[model samples]
Target: MDKTTTAAPSAAALAAGRRAGWLRELRETFTLAWPLVIAQVAQNALITTDVIMMGWLGPKQLAAGTLASTFIMPFLVGAVGLISAIAPLVAQARGARNIRAVRRIVRQGFWATIILSALLIPLILQVKPIFLFLGQNPETTMLAEQYIQIGVAMFIPGLAVVVLRSMLSAFNTTRIILVLTLAAVVVNAIGDYLLMFGVFGLPRLELRGAAIATVVTNLFMFVVFLAYVLNHKRFRRFHILWNFWKPDWHHLAQIFRIGTPIGMTVLAEVGLFTAAALLMGLIGTNEIAAHAIAMQSASMAFMVPLGLGVACTVRVGYAYGRGDDEGVRKAGWTALGLSTAFMTVSCITFILGAPLIVTIFLDPDRAANTDALRLGASYLVVAGLFQLVDGAQVVAAHALRGLSDTKVPMLVAIVSYWFIGLPIAYVMGFTFNLQGVGIWLGLAAGLAFAAIVLVIRFAMRERLGLLRRTL
Candidate 1:
């Protein structure tokens, strides 16, 4: 009543209201972004940490790690993309209030992953000869083979973590991925410290030690995730482990049917990079070293958008699960918008600071790379321009998977990354003599095409009411 005394509701009120807004936005963003962000950052940090640790071992270790990661990618790639099947499937079951279905799906995913890992384990040995055939320097190949042989042993349990974690994510346990990934990263760091320097009375395995560190961390994460799932009330009450033991051949077939296209497409894209590494080797170590530096820098950038991509999948799946057609459309747009916004800043950072970034991974004094730095900067700058579309396409494609339309998007990715991207890069880098930048330009064109086509697919699916309907 004493109007002068009201005093604009005091400074504390303003601060509290501001804090409230921040909290609300954070909660929403967390719901939409945290799991995805953490997942991406953890993975990027893992590789970055690995690089930093392995750098201590020698340049040869760096080369070995690079070669090993690219080679086993195909085996891992198929499993990675295919595992997304569990998220949307479980999301749908959650939406339907079908606890039994969720349990069954989770069980089937484990079954699928185990089978795939078993098949891939044997292929790991073939990696050595394959690298030699690809013209890897004999020294690099020798160290790379050591890493591949020991590192891949983790695949058995690793696949289970991938599948099961995804299954839980489908149920809205998205935070688990970040939590588990963080745990794994810590474990790996300790293992690396112990194994790399002969800490704790352990033998110094060098590159092989790094590989073992990763495998051991993966194993620890698998057990942690499995224990959580098995002990959870929802899973236990439904007898998820006991009753959902048998495979649902039909659903399994459905997963392969829906998943294969996207899986293969992703495989093809990663395969291109692997082949590019090999081709760079043919140009000489100076070029490959520069190329590796650029690639690693981009890989770090790739993680941010990758996290966005995973978020897109979750948002799209959640919308589809709820039979919210408009929500699906909006979610797709929002995820892409988020990716574009994030990557736009990233693109600028890389293009402007490419040289500085490369320097972190390379010892400039001993580099012996005549024009690798210049060429690497140019390659990354151009590659940076395409980062937006690269992320957008990945998000859109995963959204399409939420719409249960993986086949078309898969085809689009395969054609764009392989038939279009690789060929262009090959010709530009060789035929046109554009060299390093040429390869990246090829990558740009492919990402651009993919972004456009996948967006169109997402739009078309939305218009047809596909998002609200089940397969």
Candidate 2:
């Protein structure tokens, strides 16, 4: 009997030990993740700020700005995803202590950014016809075109910022991003106030002014990040700017192979959301406004998981490069667990505070916004239900990217968003008479499918010891 009692205590002690180890890994992951979260949230705050200012202008301006952003966003986000290949590349190089590889990766990243910017500029310039083709309201389409024309100026600088931020964050120098992004947020808010309202002797540009403010903010952020990377002591070893402005075809090809699929994956996800936005426009202007408000709220909440996903890339990449498979698994799992926990809390908050959160974006006293506010509040509930799966999918996808497994995940995203999400959205919103709510439910279903498949992929790769396989 005494021996049996001792055996039970021993088993309990082992279980306790495993839990303690899990907590330690989680703590370390959070330590790296929080600065990234702060930076991402600050970065996204720029858009939130613009939306708030646009809302104050009127529903027409708000809807127009939101529509224009939807058109521009997929391209910008895809390019950002492309440039993000540099983060894992740099992290791996850092793990291997290969300064030359880091320099080569960043140089190719810069070239890709230039190439992507050139391609995207023409796309933004064609927004007028695109909006017309989509059958948008004529007046709103004209306003949206104007807004996008000005926003085009920010694209190049914004992509450059993405590359620089990736490099710095991969090096574990995240504090700089947090500081610079916070400063840019302040500048953006003040700039929008001055330009949008024409305060303090400035001409009131309204919607146009918002675009200008964003341009200035993007330019400022690029300059600051460039200055830091160039002048910082930490980067001196890599000789990052050696030959300054030359191209290497071989390295560029490597970047393209890895980054292009990543870019497409991002576009696939963004396309789903943008398509939903366009569908909302067809339903009605109020539906579009409500969709924008709910999406913006969900996006703000998403920043936390997005940042964690980024940090996981660095952690997992570093481990993979060092041939530490166990370390990679731990890092990946810790990130997923942390992300799920955080999103769980966010999900609860959104469900509980849906109305209060929606109220922040519009004037509650305004009769024009009544329908929008109601739809937005209800959409927040659907957003809440999917937050966990959304968080899981992003983390899993990023981890796979760290392992240099981009192509399969790209296919997963294509099937999940385009094949599954959109069809369901269309049928539910139109055919079934569910309208806007049905569309949102379809989004949740797609995200859930993505999360499940991605988690399985990650687990399979890790179990098979394929994570360390060369691309």
Candidate 3:
């Protein structure tokens, strides 16, 4: 007897299965991402708090602090990327249950952080001469130098926090990292109040107070995180403390090979923004202050997508380690979706609240700040327009990094920012007289370009099943 022919599954069934997969991926990514997002915001609080307190001092201080930070941030961010070599390694190790590899990666992360921090000191010391050579206002440049000098004191500890966070993020131990960063925030805020205003009879250090507060907060975070990682029973199995100082040249070299590109990519993006800030300095102090205010707000919003990117790296890295190509695709795409959704909301918020948001960093009642307030509000509009594209590119880049495909993304960033973005910024700001708005438009276009290219790259890599390829 012939059996009844079975019907193939309908399109509706296939669509339903796809929807279920997306829902499952989104839920998993959200679980991994939210705590990480909070941790990032809290960590940024260390800087945001400094900027806010500096704002209270007056416009000149704000401008000076902003300029100094622009120069120093590239170095700090690049160092973080160098240390980021730990994330994928630790994630993959955990996935494979290779405790020994995890320990070795952590130890080498420490070594990398030290080497990078030492290399940054000479650059930090020359800030005064460099800014002077750039024709910055002598008073403003000197103030900037003062702040950066104090800030350099915290580099090692700050990088230690980064390395420790990378490892914890891979293990999805973000909640603990969140708690520690929050404590650092509180300490930083209280310290800023005490030192900046001379509250409780402490010296009124003004901008220097902001720098000192940041340094203290860095130390607090590093010590607490180190203690937990070393003593906590959950980390005990890895024996991270045993031979912690042991030198491992091969692994360290491997880290640099993987890390240098990541570091350069970060520098490329940060350098563009920092270059914009410096260009604003040439326009006038008012413009510089306004740019700082608008950029600060944009940066706060950016932490959400930035954290999602980190989560994507860990999730995709874990899946890669396990040889789960499908898992890698799901993790990357879910992260992209989440970042897009969040940036949409943020963009809308920035547009609607431009006036109110810019005022937060300035003293609204002060007539002296009227120009800065007006200029800052307008700049926020530009900031709002770019949020979606900015989020897309950053998340896409991180997704590729997770798949160990950073070299191409680095090239994409260089071309997008240097060859395209900065040239437009210069032409518009000067030749076309768009000023600050023109510079910001260039940033938006560059991010859009990078986003399109990097997203396509990730798609192709997935299709080709190259997610397992490491540097």
Give the best candidate by TM-score: 3
Clashes found in each candidate (C-alpha, N, C closer than 3 A): 0, 0, 0
**CA-only RMSD, every prediction:** 6.0, 2.4, 1.9
lDDT of 1 by residue, 1-471 (tens): 666567557766887986775455335534856676777688667767777676556556766777788888777878878866887777666766666677677777777777788777898888778878766788889888888888988777877887777776666666778887887788888888888778878898888888888888888988988888778875556455665567689778766776677678788788888877777777765566667677777777777767766666766777677776655666677667777888899899988898887667656676454365666777778878988888888888877877777877778878898899899989999999887778878888888898999888787884665655653
What would the per-residue lDDT of candidate 2 be over residues 157-189, giving only the tens digit for each residue?
898888889899788889899999999999999
Task: Please identify model 2 stretches exceeding 4 Å from their true place.
Answer: 1-24, 463-465
TM-scores for every predicted model: 0.89, 0.95, 0.96
Clashing residue pairs, backbone N/CA/C < 3 A, model 3: none
What is candidate 2's CA lDDT for residue 102?
80
Q: Would you give me the overall lDDT of model 1?
A: 0.75
Weakest ten-residue segment in model 3 by summed lDDT = 1-10
Ranked candidates (TM-score, high to low) = 3, 2, 1
How accurate locally, in lDDT, is each candidate? 0.75, 0.89, 0.87
Say which prediction, candidate 1 or candidate 3, comes out ahead on TM-score: 3
Candidate 1: stretches off by over 4 Å? 1-30, 199-201, 243-245, 365-375, 463-465
Ranking of predictions according to lDDT:
2, 3, 1
